[model samples]
Target: MKVLIVDDNQKALVIAKARLGKEELDVLCASSGKDCLEMVRKTTPDLILLDLDMPDMSGFEVCKILKSDNDLSMIPIIFLTATDDTTNRINGLDLGAVDYVTKPFDPFELRARVRAALRTKQLQDQLAELNRNLEDRVEQRTVEINQLLNQKDAFINQLSHDLRTPLTPLVALLPMVLKKIEDTEIKKILDLAIKNVGYMKNLTEKTLQLAQLNSSRLQLKMEKVDLKDEIIDTLDSLSSIFSEHGVKIVNNINSPIQVEIDKVLIKELVHNLISNSVKYMKDEGGITIDGFQNSKDVRISITDTGIGMTHDQLNHIFEEFYKADNARHDRSSSGLGLSICKRIIEKHGGSIYAESQGVNEGTTVHFTIPL
Candidate 1:
């Protein structure tokens, strides 16, 4: 590789060339900064060995010019100096020299520094090239993956439509048959199967909704929604479960706060929170739904006096497929509810967080959506 040695000191330049020459480097010498610039313009070298003190312009000036010029910026420059002062060393380094060698320098150390700089430059070049290639490959793969995903989504939509068309008749017939059945045990079994089938349909619908939300195909119909009403509706939907568990619902939503949000998505968000509360609450425990409007955000909190979470559980509650240790024991949940809630809140320029003192100490899930 080509190397330009720039220094007014002929002895220093000769010694540097002699030491670096043993490695068979193509060394060119310049006695001043002006000559160094001319030499660089004439032939761009891979590296430059520069002297801090020069009769004409100093090495620092040359380094500054070289660094500022787009054409010369990539070439590494190493400074050779006699001064041991901290300021001069910092100034030299800040001017973009890769390494500073103090004089009268050890020849071996100088050679080692040069070799190390060259190796670093080579590695950097390789890394940059690899990154460019990797990026191109990644972009191409992303396009291909997206194409495949679109095809898969189309297939799923078609399959769901076709399956539901046939299932509609069976779903309608099941209830009629159950109504006429004389055996109570058989009728009960059929009813449970029908209920489970309904649950399956709900899961499929939720899955489709999640996919649409992920693909940015789900357009939210935003409107000024009364948060209090939304919370009440969600609570009403979970009334049966709450009653079954002997849990009391407390509404502290004072002074109805209106926030611009998609009613459907907000309903889902509230439903998930309330459902979770109901699922985890101890027998006869109470759940409170509260809302208030701050200056630029409306904050809603669902506080459940239930089998609360640990600090670690609270930290990961919103992660997809992340159920608390206690919740995992049931294994009945898909664990997508809180994750979906997080996505919905974030899509509306909001944030959600879970807080707990500790296990069995109750937990509060708070979310804020901008008004």
Candidate 2:
């Protein structure tokens, strides 16, 4: 450790330097407070032994100036006094002195105090270095995570594109081929092929959409839209499915509720929730689409008389590819529907959750949209 001894008396400086030098420390001597400050500016010492009485400036004043500087404030200062005066010791300490050493210093006491001060400074420096290293590591890890996510999104997009390229031709030609065929067995096989192709197309589209929703690349196109009209439009689009399942949709939202939202995403949200409800329902049941205006946002609920889920099932309902008892084996369900709905609502700065009593009861899905 480097130690600087500042004293107006040349004899005192020499004596102090000789005593501390024996302890394997680099001892630098200054004849006055001004010289001490000047030397400190040139080379910062780890510890300072300042004489209380000086010709150029008092040790208290020099201490105050050093402590005020952010760069030099951390260097420990020890006041060297001729007498054990209580007031002087307190004033020196208040000015940021680490400890006080009486004049005609004892070699043992001086060396011990200097070691203690240097040890504390070493620990503080170590801690600051650790904090800086931690910050760098956290920043590096964040960049790595972001890169990995981008690569994953790109792979999903490319795969979806590749799958759709071949399915497109089959989707269009298989239906026409089935229509022209007269043989019953041949027509049945072509129809089945068309259905499977259609399923693949749907799966590709949903997977691409889900991947986009999960990534940071997707941006919401916000606009003011009528909530009732959006819900009505979604119901119209899925009208055939509801009819096929013999399910009734009761639109209970009467008011023209206006909300700032991404129109396409909100429509998809309603479509997925409503379609999912019908899928799990019995042959004939009712789906109630209800909404109410609250202070901060609008709350909508889709209640269905379906084969209700248990508490555990409701907990994982929004997870991607998570299927309940019936949906687990049901090929018709891609299981990404509700997961997309959840992402849509969250992107709109809203929340979504489900409530189900138990099996053979019912399920209600609640979602919110900000005003």
Candidate 3:
């Protein structure tokens, strides 16, 4: 350890150096606070023995300056004073002095105090090093995780595109094959094959859309959109399913509500929520779509008289490929529909949640988008 002893009295400085000198330590002497500050900048000692009274600067001022500096603040300081009064000692310690050695000092006690201060400073340096390494590791891991996610998205896009090419020719030929066959059982089997192909196509499309939405950078084509018109258009598109299920949709939003949004994405969000409720609904059940606005946001809700979900099912409803037993039995659902809806809403700086009254009662889906 290298210790710098600072005092205006050269004799006192020499005495302090002699007392703390040992085979393992080197002692540096300074006649004034200014000399001490300069030597500290040139060679940063492990610890300092500072005298409170000096011609140019007081020890209190020197301690404050050292403690405020980024590089020198970690070096422990031991104040050497003539009188050990409570106020002087407190004032010195308050300015970051680690220990005090009074004049007419015991040589053995001074050496002990210097040893303890160096040990404390060593621990502090170790802790600072550990913190720096931890921060670097966390930053590196974050970059690695982001890179892996990008690769996964690229793979999903390629897989989805490749999967559709072969299906197109097979889909066009299936109908012709059915017409060429006269046996009723053979025709039914061909129809089933066509249905399964359609299901696969839908699953692929949904997967591609989900991957795009979850990418790190998502851009929206923003414009002033009439939400009522969007909802009406979506309902018309799904009119066939509504009729087949004996489902009626009631739109309570009468006004032409204009909102800033990406029209295509909002339409998809509405379609997914409405279709999801339709799938679980009872015969002759009804669906209601409503909207309201506050100062900072707009809220939209879709409520249905459907076979509602249990607590556990609702908890995992928005998770990708998470489905209740009924949904698992359903051929129409890819289990990605609700997941897509949630991602779209969140991308618009919005939130979505589901509410249900146990099983077989009803369910309501609510979403909010920032204004």
| Every model: Cα RMSD to truth | 6.6, 3.6, 3.6
lDDT of each prediction vs. the true structure? 0.85, 0.90, 0.88
Error of 2 at 73 (Å): 3.9
TM-score of candidate 2 on Cα atoms, chains taken together: 0.81
Instruction: Give per-residue CA lDDT, model 3, range 7-88, as digits (tens).
Output: 9888887888777767378899888888899999999999999999776799998999999999999889999888878888
Residues 1-371, candidate 1, lDDT per residue (tens digit)?
88899989888888888889898889999999999999998999888999998977998999999999998898899898888878888988888888888888898898899999988888977998999999999999999998988887797788778867877876788889989999989998998878866656655666666666676455678898788888888788888888899999889886778888999899989988888888887799998877878799988989999888888888888887687776674434666788888989988999999998998999999999998
lDDT of 2 by residue, 1-371 (tens): 78999999989988888888878988998888899999999889999999999876999989999999999999999999999899999998888899999988899999898989889989988998999999999999999988998889879878887988888789888888888889999988887777777777777787888888988878899998899999999999999999999999899999999999999999989888888888788999999989999789999999999999899998999998898876676657777888999999999999999998998798999999988
Task: Name the best candidate (by lDDT).
Answer: 2
Instruction: Please state the error at residue 28 of candidate 1 in Å.
Output: 2.8
Q: The CA-based lDDT of model 2 is what?
A: 0.90
Query: Compared to the true structure, candidate 1 yields what TM-score?
Result: 0.61
Give per-model TM-scores. 0.61, 0.81, 0.81
Record all residue pairs in model 2 with backbone atoms less than 3 Å apart, i.e. clashing: none
